[model samples]
Target: MGHHRAHVSQGHERGGGQTHEEHSGSHGHGGHDGHRGHDGHAEVFRRLFWVSLVLAVPVVALSPMFADLLGYTVPRFPGASWVPPVLGSVVYAYGGRPFLTGAVQEARARKPGMMLLVALAITVAFAASWATTLGLTATLDFWWELALLVVIMLLGHWLEMRALGAASGALDALAALLPDTAERLTDEGSEQVPLDALRADDVVLVRAGGRVPADGVVVDGSAHVDESMISGESRPLRRAAGDRVVGGTVATDSTLRVRVTAVGSDTALAGIQKLVADAQASGSRAQALADRAAAFLFWFALVAGVLTFGVWAALGDMPDAVERTVTVLVIACPHALGLAIPLVIAISTERAARAGVLVKSRLALERMRTVDTVLFDKTGTLTSGRLTLVGRAAVAGLDDDELLALAAAVEADSEHPVARAVVAAHAGDTPAATDFRSLPGRGVRAVVGGREVHVGGPALLAELGLEVPSELGEAVTHGQQNAASVLHVVRDGAVVGVLAVADAVRPESRAAVDALHAHGVRVAMVTGDAQHVAQAVAHELGIDEVFAEVLPADKDAKVVELRERGRRVAMAGDGVNDAPALTRADVGIAIGAGTDVAIESAGVVLASDDPRGVVSVIVLSKASYRKMWQNLVWAAGYNLIAVPLAAGVLAWAGFVLSPAVGAVMMSASTVVVALNAQLLRRVDLDPGTVTGRAADSPSR
Candidate 1:
């Protein structure tokens, strides 16, 4: 991990992240148009590998030197010797084209890498083998080695190339989430049309089991929208008139006519896709370092090959010296080293997307593993964003129904969350009233049933100098302790009833907090709610810290203060007022994924409102880093040992590595690295699995 650590250290100095331009320029991996080029390389190398391997079988078997080394005999035939020379040449020209051309590009750029090393080894072997077949030099007959080298290098690259395209697979999956066409509502009736033909304000008829054509508000009808592709919620959300629905989400149970507010790039699907593509293009800091390391390996192997030839020739064996040099150069494939980090980064991002965690920045993925504390914005993050009527109480003269109806009538004119909850809770007719007036923090004052009635929190009770009677005091205290928004109802300045409006905690919140805690992360809650309320919710969720009554403008100060205390903080919020704080934190985790604020304010978006995505990000970071380290150590170790052995360092012990053995080791190392990186996809990041038993929220 020495060189791997160097990569991370340099990344830290550069803000623990890198740009897409730097990744491409530094890698100079022939083609750098993100994964598009990688996919091309994968297909090319896969074909090259299989063809070269087939041709190598004969070239290897027909070689006298190979027969002698392996104690096997080939049938004496006139054309048998020609088989090696002819097939080997074809293998070099066809299979070696990619590496040879790639080496030329690197040479022109004055930056060499694995391609140059592989090219040099095969060129030397091809030249020497032909010469020996014509009796030009002794002991330079290595057609078998040349053929195998090309085949093995091709195989190594083929495997690495496939792994590098993992990000592309995720991108394609995202694109495939949308339907090919949509039903548009027109004056003549609904007609099928392409998404591109649709415009803003175009009404789309989404039938049961069809995806929403665009981001819009439901104008008519109701349905359960499954936004799992965008929001990561497995369950379909109920959608009704005036409710917003994102494009690409499914209308699961009923039909809905939606008024399109956004199309094309403005859709949430487009936004999420762009964020993902941007992150994938950047690559990981370690991948950039590996590219540099590959360049270094090329120079290292070249210098060592020259030294090996010089020493051996000085001992009076020019032909064997050239072969030994060829062995050393080819032994340094560098494929494993080249793949060590990038493949891990690619697979991690892919897995993150599947878990509803969109990693919009490599630095966020890199730093999440280091986070020791998480600051959560309370209201819309831990709790459902909307207020629901939870409990009600009444005075001796009125029944519960009458009290609720009176309160609803008074609150009908107000649009406050508390008022909405009260109006939504009332099942019977609410009496009409006029003389509606706003009291700001104190609550609303309106004429209900021709009597002046008031509704508000405890502040309104204090302003009116009214104490809660013993009949409703118990419920009021209970509501206050649970952080429920208690609204006091008054008639003609006298207390009449009370209602409890609560933002019920999401069922996923407890599991998320528990999982973070299990990972040794300290959970803290920050909100504009009062101390008592914040503390009550914090206690219920088992959070370790609580910062209550925090104004939206001061949220960032809390993040800055925590970071100044030597704690690595990750701020997860609703991405509204918490934008500044999110930008200030070491890692910004915007809880709501598809929201513009979430996408713009944070480095990481939870595409779903589930808090467990925080854990997923951390888990993926650590897992990816572990794979990077594993691959680096294996590749570095293989090069270290194989280079010396191939250079005949162990010849005195009769344990020297032949060129064929070196080629085998190179491909094996690459296979090992790719398999290890692929293992990341096996990581279970589902929020439901976080704590094993998340308590369910009772339906209202």
Candidate 2:
């Protein structure tokens, strides 16, 4: 249980969940003490490594090989046979101390684990040899085997710890990237000070290539910034005076003087980091299962080993009984069992990272394998988030390009996003306009080269007492039906032409949906947009369902509803509002970039603003899960077969297995499991395969 909690905490915080919701969710799922125990385990493992390595030297020196190789016969000291027994006890106490400690802790909690088996094995071996030295019977030197087994366990644990540290350390590194200091501007010059000492409304000066130390609004300079870390989109954003720059974004090739608006943990990036840490630390259903399994194995092995000693000793062969007991203890050690799931989790996690998916929760990847229904947030997930021109309507006398140029000139002076897009589409620099009036919900009215010009929605034409032909009205209706925003261009108080713009579907999104469908996954679109807009996008993608105009509060409800209907849903979204829904789904995938909530709520983050990444995660999860299952089967199966063989089950059948042979077989099984898990790296999740099937979308 502690192991699962430890892994969860490490995974989330490291993955990038650092929000209030993520923190609360993690706490609700599980506490942070599991991680504390992991720390304890690591400390014990290090101490054991040195202790075991030391004991190994004496074990070799006491071996028969020592005397044979030296070609000398040595006199035995009085009661010198006790030397091995004393040294074996020292090894058990130092090299095997953690197991003993863990066994005691587990026993106190009314649970037991692999540590109990290890402790019992080493304890029994030492006790048996010690008794023989006391003149009770013929002495056997099991000190070598005991020392070697502990050394092997120490090495295994060290490797396991290294893997865990590597997986978790990356996340901590990301969180650490936020600079602790900022340059605060005063009347004379700027001074370097701790970011936490900064206050809202304080002016700050950021130089070229410096991260924004806190959330602030630019006031005196302009620059291009790479916000990829915070937003997940690789595009370089141009920040001018009055634009907001988030903390933790790299200032690329520009100097900016900004007024701080948020500081300390209130910053967006800090919140994201906190949320990720909390989500990872929290316990989930998957972790509960792992804990239960470990507890069960610990108890089963302990009882079996004890019963084995009792049964064999009652038959009057104490040394044979001790060997069997020690074998049970060594063979049933939970090292493999403890590592199996965590290793799979760690490898898969790193693989996802390389693929540009930052996993915030462990259960997210596991649950992705079972997701049958996918819900996408339309704005940033399915559509390009930015509106684009889709169609043009001709006036009675004007061509398409002529109408576009006139409209672009009229709207050029406007600061609205749509206006900027229209001007950008004209593809050339133009002279400044003389007169311009921005009508609220409508377009703008201006004078371009002294010719009265108007660019706005169709309602602007009616408000200006203009009359339009039926043909033009039909065009407007057609545009609206296709989910376009109809912009009427009126010159001299009459409607002359129209431009249709809408939040267009991404080029690869429809294909991604189709690919999912081909893989037997149902696609659904969930959006805050109006019914007509959402419906048009869904129809275009051939989606199975549409949930439109839903507020952020209700996002999670949709996921829960789908699950209640027996559909395992994967929700992909962007924006701070989608955090709850992302956390609620079977798998939470964040698209492009956004606030900390967006990154922390989701299990996977797509570095690129493309829907195809979701497909990559789905296919990868399936592949990784399959590999884990295969490894688990082989590891468990090998242990099952080898345990019986080592106990001499086949001796009467004239196929007796020696201890050395059994050890070789066990080592081979570990190698096989490790190799099988490594094979996941070779799985092909080609972007083309995830995009679409040709047969599904012939129009493309």
Candidate 3:
């Protein structure tokens, strides 16, 4: 990552053999590492700044120019003149070692940039000061300027390194999600072994509260798995003998014997790591452009330095020529330019991680600000992906709660989604049912309080030749039009109530849509659901467009069509079917406890199911882009102004800029960039902050 020998990646492998070297290697170039690599760069710069600052004090105090400017004598003493040169040389070799070596490497690579410019300035100043100290020239001494320049440059770099260190959480934290050892069920009995010993078809025993060692299917036993880390679902899911379990999920309350279906690189967790590594491998366009800017500045300063010396020499003032040339080169260092994009990227990544957003692709983050349309998958993304009780109607004699209690008791032993939804919705104590029997497609029949109760759909009613009363039919007809699942509570051969189980649109979806509308971005829904069902959801959320009954294979074509119409599009989805479209869009976002295959294809992955996480992405992209441009403008503009002044272009106006003053301008420009980037951390991304219509909105 550093492009320096001190980068120090020991190649430690953990969690499916992903080595730290692979992680560090993806960090782009020497300048914009993007905060994914290395550990001690900030400490190195911090140490250099303090040591250089200390040595600079003696050099500055002993300089005749420094004492003259302050209207004080140089503490006249024997060998005092030797003090500035001696301390100044020590600062150049020790404090400027990093720049000196970096400049050499850049020269060998046939490229000139910030490091070369910095090294040239200090080296020239060092030579000129020594020449003057030895009586070659009386007025070219610049020991104080050289000392201050090195100290200030080191301080700027120290702050830049520290900012990057706080970026996205350490990759080691991802590795720690896996256990070092696993319990393998062998021919004799269960035995403890390292994770590497695991292979396909190997049976492993997972105890209560233990993480699954690898992705596998439950061969024996059952448990409610806490998969919030893997799927972003808050509730624990029950995994029986046939359910699949991902590696990194915890078995919360019981034991499970699993047959490993995947291990090492084949595991789902390993797939997530691969997606991140690939994203980092694809470098950023802005980073490359900044590097080129530094290259351009390098050549510009070199030509300026050469021309300044030639012009001043033609006037027969060689002492003035050397001083002006040194000033021109020193002021050309691109400290702010080198730090601009990297600092913004670092802060953006930090904020994204806190908001449960994983930026798999840097380009996606950069492009989100320009997206004009966001197309979302309807089933699991905009909706809750599970049936929820939304409506119920009862006969005149029966209360709604009474009808609900009867249906819940009859559906208690069933595993159907509709049955589960009904049972879960009951808040009161459920009276025990007797003689429970599954009626297959018709429904479930059981005896509760000596009454034969049946809970089912229209098929159950048809078999019994029953008709719903007008009161229940009103609710049933409305629910059917919206594609909700309707079931009847038939007790004592009489139809009493009808309950509606629909794919509940998440409460956050409405706010998510409203926020997008406020940003002037059109919200669109893509679903395989019927037209009426899709429009029902679209109208409720104030969506601008809808694409219903769209087959999964055709979803990519929709994204392509949007692009064809000259609008930037973003696709958000979470199914294997959504993978193609996620890859086809300009910015692909995988949201809402997404499937692994979808994450593999998406540029950004939201670990939480909150649809409002989409708003956070747009907010981050626009804010970070604004900072990058601001820093670049200030850095480039400062050089344009400072370079001319340093070259004595203002000499006719009696206002020639000195080297110490140029050094201050360079350091101040860099500090402004760093501090401006830090402001991004203050942005609130609570998922409610942007949606003003939401009750939980926070201050901007």
Q: How does each model score on lDDT?
A: 0.76, 0.65, 0.76
TM-score of 2: 0.75
Cα error of candidate 2 at position 304, Å: 3.5
- C-alpha displacement of 557 in model 2, angstroms? 6.1
Give the best candidate by lDDT.
1
Question: For model 1, how does the per-residue alpha-carbon lDDT over 1-700 read when each residue is reduced to its tens digit?
Answer: 0111111111111111222222323333333345666677678778888999999998989988778777888878877779999999999999888777767766887877766766787888888788888988766677887887777667766665676565556656766777888899889888999989999989999999988878898999999898766654566778887678888788999999999898888777667766766676655677766777787777788788888889889989777697788778766767677667766776787777766787888878998889999999877688776677888899998999999998888889876656777888898988897899888657788897679998877667777899988888898889888777778889987898888877777777888888788889999988777677778788888999998767788999999889999999999986766889999999999986553622677889887677777887888888888887898889878887788788887777888787666766777887888788889878876665644544353312
Q: Write the per-residue lDDT of candidate 2 for residues 1-700, one digit (tens) a residue.
A: 0111111111111111122122112112233323233344456567778777887766645643234445655447685545566776788777877666656655665655555555665676566556555766453345655676677667656544444444344444554787788899998988999977899999988899988888888898889987655543445677876667887777898899989888766765555544444434544454455455556655665666677678768888677666666565556554455445555655665555534465667677777888899998877567666556777787777877888888888878776656765776776656456688777645688887788888876457657877666768887787777767777788777778887777667766878887788778999987766677667778878899988767667889999999999999998887467789888887888776433433656777664456877787887788877776676566555656655555545656976444434444555565566666667667644444445442124423
Report the C-alpha lDDT of model 3 over 111-205, residue by residue, as the tens digit.
Answer: 77767777887888888889889998776678987888788777766665565554333333544777889999989998999999998999999
**C-alpha TM-scores of all predictions:** 0.87, 0.75, 0.79
Give the winner by TM-score. Answer: 1
> Residue 124 CA error for candidate 2 (Å)?
2.2
Over all chains combined, what TM-score does candidate 1 have?
0.87
Off by over 4 Å in 3: 1-37, 66-78, 168-282, 428-454, 458-467, 480-483, 490-494, 593-598, 690-700
Report how far off residue 327 is in candidate 1 (Å).
1.3
